[model samples]
Target: MFAVIRTGGKQYVVKPGDRIKVEKLEANVGDTIEISEVLLVNKEGEVKLGNPVVEGAKVVASVVDHAKGPKVIVFKKRAKKGYKRKKGHRQLITTIEIKEIL
Candidate 1:
């Protein structure tokens, strides 16, 4: 079975054994988290879509690690003007392994 879940203002399609990086979560590594914002679920050719979210549907996942995403450089400049700015940012992220869709 597969499920679409929302976390940290983002959505992700996941299945058992699949590992994905998502916005930072508060739990420590090896902690199991249940994502209840299930938007859709597919089971052996059967599909169920939710009106906002499916009732009683959830996804179980285990936190694998915590890391930072790649740096993004932001630069701005104006022609004939001495206005310039540069900034870099790295997003905090959590790596989790999907264990089941329930």
Candidate 2:
């Protein structure tokens, strides 16, 4: 089965055993977390879509590791004024493996 779940202000489509990186979550590796904001679920052609979220539906996942997303650079410059600025950032992320959709 596959499910659409919301976490970290984003939505992801996942299935059992699938691994994905999501915005940082306060959990350690090997910890199991339940995503209760399930938007949709499909099982053997049977589908369930939530109005906002499916009532009583959840996706179970296990934290694989903590990670950091690729660095992003921001540069700014002003014409003849001789002004320039540069910045870089890396977003914190978490890797989780989908265990089941229920």
Task: Give TM-scores for every candidate, taking all chains together and pairing residue i with residue i.
Answer: 0.97, 0.95
Clashes in model 1: which pairs?
A: none
Clash count for each candidate, listed in order shown: 0, 0
lDDT by residue (tens digit), candidate 1, 1-102: 889999999999999999999999999999999999999999999999999999999999999999999999999999999999999999999999999999
Model 2: per-residue Cα lDDT over 1-102, one tens digit each: 899999999999999999999999999899999999999999899999999999999999999999899999999999999999999999999999999999
Against the true structure, whose lDDT is highest?
A: 1
By summed lDDT, the worst window of 10 consecutive residues in model 2 runs over 1-10
Q: What is the lDDT of candidate 2?
A: 0.96
The global C-alpha lDDT for each of the candidates, from Candidate 1 onward, is 0.96, 0.96
The regions of model 1 sitting more than 4 angstroms off are none
Screening candidate 2 with a backbone cut-off below 3 angstroms (N, C-alpha, C), the clashing residue pairs are none
The CA lDDT at 94 in model 2 is 98
